[model samples]
Target: MIDPTGRPPAEATGPRRAARPERLEGLVVGLVANPKKNAEQFLDAVGDLLAAEHGIADVVRTRKTSITDPIPPATLDELAQRCDVVLIGVGDCGSCSAAAVADGIAFEAAGVPAAVICTDAFRVSADAMARLQGSPGYAYVTTAHPVAPLDEAGVRERARQALSDVLELLVQAPVPVAAR
Candidate 1:
């Protein structure tokens, strides 16, 4: 399909995909946490689950400055260099949720398997952002809404319930650009 500007389709910009590892076992995982309330707590629980259940060797965690903004290129580059697969999380609102999915796409573009976590309420927003960003059907994990007000036990329980889904998505091999 031709675009309006008479360009055949804007070619995806950036380095070609990095090599995807065969598995997550003993791999270094990157966690890009959005700076919304309890975002780190939510991701930390998920990270714990990844370590305990999936045998993820180590996690390099970074917090984005704000959810409404794009993830810093340096952080992505660093995670790309230091980690194998990544999990970007706590997209409980519209903007942050979209950012998480976009970040996931960026990780995949760089050949790292990634999954974005959000509340069920923001699932549609995350999926829509993925589509708008040229990668429709990007997989993500969702938990209950109102995560910010939740106590530790509440978030932990939500994390536990959602951990399996996050594990499944993070373990998958990166989809080749052609398939996307």
Candidate 2:
């Protein structure tokens, strides 16, 4: 079978995750927004929290042209060049969830630590995508589902609740499965 994700023959390997930063202070962050409903707002809220809580120096934000497709290589390259880390999000549906996970893996392959956020409803799809992409235990954050219907305050609340997990995914090294 042809592996479209470009995984090596080894089944246990995927994109090598970037090294975690010792501190969040002064580091540039990238936010890759999927064009799904309320995705930009959700990302904005998360960016605000990261800036407020972690002292991130700046955020370089970009919106993908399509929610169901992988991020364009040029955009991914730009983010990798300009940002220390990246957060991709608001994957509320199946296709977007898979795309987000793929984008996160691509960022990691570019040597940027990435945190991918999805709604709880799409967790199965996100996890499956990770495995398909050769990252069986890739870490991603999930918020409560149905983000499209949430008002600004509601979305921010979800962001607030997901903030800690976001921070952990960005700054902390993932423990090996064997260690867990």
Best of the candidates, lDDT? 2
Per-model TM values vs. the true structure: 0.82, 0.88
Cα deviation in Å at residue 177, candidate 1?
28
lDDT of each: 0.78, 0.86
Q: Which stretches of candidate 2 lie over 4 Å from their true place?
A: 1-15, 173-180
Report the CA-based lDDT of candidate 1 relative to the real structure: 0.78
- Residue 58 CA error for candidate 1 (Å)? 0.8
Compute the lDDT of residue 85 as modeled in candidate 2: 95
- Model 1's TM-score against the true structure: 0.82
Which has the greatest TM-score?
2
Q: Please, what are the lDDT tens digits per residue for candidate 1 over residues 38-93?
A: 89998898888888877889989999988867678888889989998888889889
